[model samples]
Target: MSNESSVAAEQGTAPAAGASHNHNPSPNHTVSKDTRRRVVTASFIGNFVEWFDYAVYGYLAGVISTVFFPESDRQTALLATFGVFAISFFVRPLGGFIWGHIGDRLGRKQALSLSIVLMSVATFCIALIPGYATIGVMAPILLLLVRVVQGFSAAGEYAGASAFLVEYATANRRGLYAAVVPASTAAGLLLGSLLAALLSSVLTAEQLNEWGWRLPFLLAAPMGLIGRYIRTKLEDTPAFRELAEKDDGVKAPALAMFRTYRKQLIIATGAVLLNAVGFYVILSYMPTYLSEELGFGATESFLATTIALASYIGFIFLTGIASDKFGRKRMLITASVLFILLTVPAFMLLDTRNFLVIVLVQILLGGMLTLNDGTLPSFLAELFPTKVRYTGFAVSFNLSNALFGGTAPFMATLLIGMTASKLAPGWYLVAAAVVSLIAVLFAAETSKKPLLQD
Candidate 1:
């Protein structure tokens, strides 16, 4: 039989037999067609809301600076805003710990619902926060507090969502199902970028600085609510249900992860560095690079990024679907190698004044980043058993992101300023890609194995 036919046969047989052994309270926990659809949609929306809230800060950083830190010099205020952006990352590990523990102990659905609630409340609070003139120094202070909350919530969203999808999906479809989470992330970025562009187009810069920026943050509340509803309705994953039934779920998953899966943890963390750094560089820093270095206007930068973001969303889905058919390791290795080779040329092309060349570079760059991102969840999740899967995945992914991803734009700026070179970040990109390539080349492939069979 072909892979598709074999997968179909296995999915049909396993769920019926597995359901009898699994102890999930919901009858819908079986791997039926409807169950797979529900799981994929729930994971997608949950990740979408998490990233949508996070991406808005980068897209609207200039307006946020004007509103919350109005009294400072414009440059200083922008620095403070980006600083707060970086500060939020420090809270991710805490979020990861809390959500990972809960997910391992209770269930992925509950953990996901709590994360969305925290993120939505944080995003809404930012929308309603008074400007500096109205609230004095408390405005920025309050902003930082809310950002920490957002960071905390975000820590668990991806890991939980990925685990949820992976455990619920058929083994043959793991790569495809896992890809949806990152695809949703890219979708969120696209949505956030489009909203920022639309607002920038319609409003005067002064008006946007004063009030328009809050609209996107406020928009997150509804998305969060919808995600919460969908998540709460989801049944726990089959792997978790089976583990819980056996009383095999780790009580202190984080501790267990450190003691037992330390090597896998390191490998997973290394794997994320390239994708995390490249993602932030392309998505978050590109606008600033265009506006500050290339002398593009704010509106023009937004428009350019918006177009690139749309292309990125399409490429994310394509790369993700392709990874399933071609094997995750092969696709990831190809992406990392291509990224290492293209980093210089891509940046140089981006530096050109021709709009067509810039757009083409952005599409290819976005696609390259998507290559690893689409496959990472399955690759990392498969590195550990179910007992510490959530903890292992969360800690490794978030720490790398905090250390590398969160600082990409900030470090790139400092590097360019010090060197008087626009392409200094290419060196950082190449170094990270090299590390990721080494890790992927050495790590065992898990695409063909059953998720919890180990």
Candidate 2:
């Protein structure tokens, strides 16, 4: 069968009748179900493990802070701990450059495989580090170094996987497949929250601070291996394959991308800020925000986050389908307006100290974020052409994410520390949303075009 016939067969319907059917403006062929499944599996597993570490670090901030920086005051210790958390993000740009080069020059498969391996090694090494009481100043220093390695590897993960999904998926259904990336991230955060809640629920605070915090980090090794295993089973994306076959790889992808696509990079970077900051603050920073700042117990905080994330996961696919059916701008704009209007009120509700109310507020925030997350990866992937896709996305996404996304927790903590207000983080969310709103206003709809030609 021809490529068009294959796309129709895979989709099983026409574009108007089914959201997953071929809608590409050009004739870019996709693979069969089995190959598509392999592509998705390879993409999903790596992001799952990457975000799992992010979740653990965010959720266990209090315990980690106490164990690693007991010499400091409550606020100072938490700040120091989140400083470590924030430090990882700073390394992402460097990782993006390295992995982006590998991805653009060599292949996505190699970059992905190497990234997971490095991330896993870093997590396990972090698990083995002695606490401050055991090793003095070297403990935090060692922890910082491990985080740097993890952050570096993670820089390439979401962008690379996104390029994979976008390149592999049918024209009409890229959003649906891309939903897996953020959904897997949510799953990782949920698993981390659940584990943290369980550990805190059963163990005494002293025990948790001393030994229990190590369990999650230890699990990172096996999970990373699993991610690497799945990724190695697949070849590079079709777009990359086309480039490779033609010997069309750029000489210096980073420099070439900047020289050629600087304007597109700025636009995509602005659009990405909403996802990076909103996701980090809501999912990664919420547990800490509730327990540390709002006087909730760890169980209460984790429960709230878990429920909200579970809801977000369920809502993501529907939003993905909607973005394809509707338009990218509509979905993103709605999310931004909701975030801007609802943030201060939601933060106010979180201050109520009522369990049910907290869950409700989180659900509201999670829904808005899911709309953005569901649409973001594919939209960002579509902004650049095949040759520069990985580097453009990696550099732009990681730069925005590292500066704003990764530092969200630290920024939130700093804002609260400086202002003595628990609701200060909500304002930060507002600022990010407003920026996103402007970008979406400027961004053209990316639903039906061919990424290779874009």
Q: Highest TM-score among the candidates is held by which one?
A: 2
- Candidate 1 lDDT over 1-454, as tens digits, reads 4332343243322222322322233453467898889888888888999899988998888788778886666556667887888888888877788888998999888899999999998998889999888988899999999998988899999898888888877777777788888888878988888888789889998889888999999988899999999988877888888777767666799987776567778878889899888988888778777787777777778777778877777777777677667877798898889989999888888788677787778878888888888889888877767777788789888988888888787777777878888898887888889998887776666676655421
Q: Model 2, which residues run further than 4 Å from truth?
A: 1-30
In model 1, which runs have C-alpha deviations exceeding 4 angstroms? 1-29, 70-75
Per-candidate TM-scores read 0.91, 0.93
Model 1 Cα shift for residue 248 (angstroms):
1.4
Residue 20 lDDT (model 1) = 34
Q: Least lDDT summed over 10 consecutive residues: which range in candidate 2?
A: 13-22
Given candidate 1, what's the lDDT at residue 414? 70
Q: List pairs with backbone clashes in candidate 1.
A: none
Tens digit of per-residue lDDT, candidate 2, span 1-454: 5344333333222222323222232245456799999888778778999878766888898888977776868889988998998888898888778888899889888888888888888888877999999988998999899888889988988888888888888878989988889998898899999999999999999889888999999998889889888888887877777677668678788887776667667777888888889999999899989988988989989999999999999999899898888877789999889999999999999998999999999998999998899998888887666777788889889999989998898899999989998889999999999998887786666776555422
TM-score of 2: 0.93
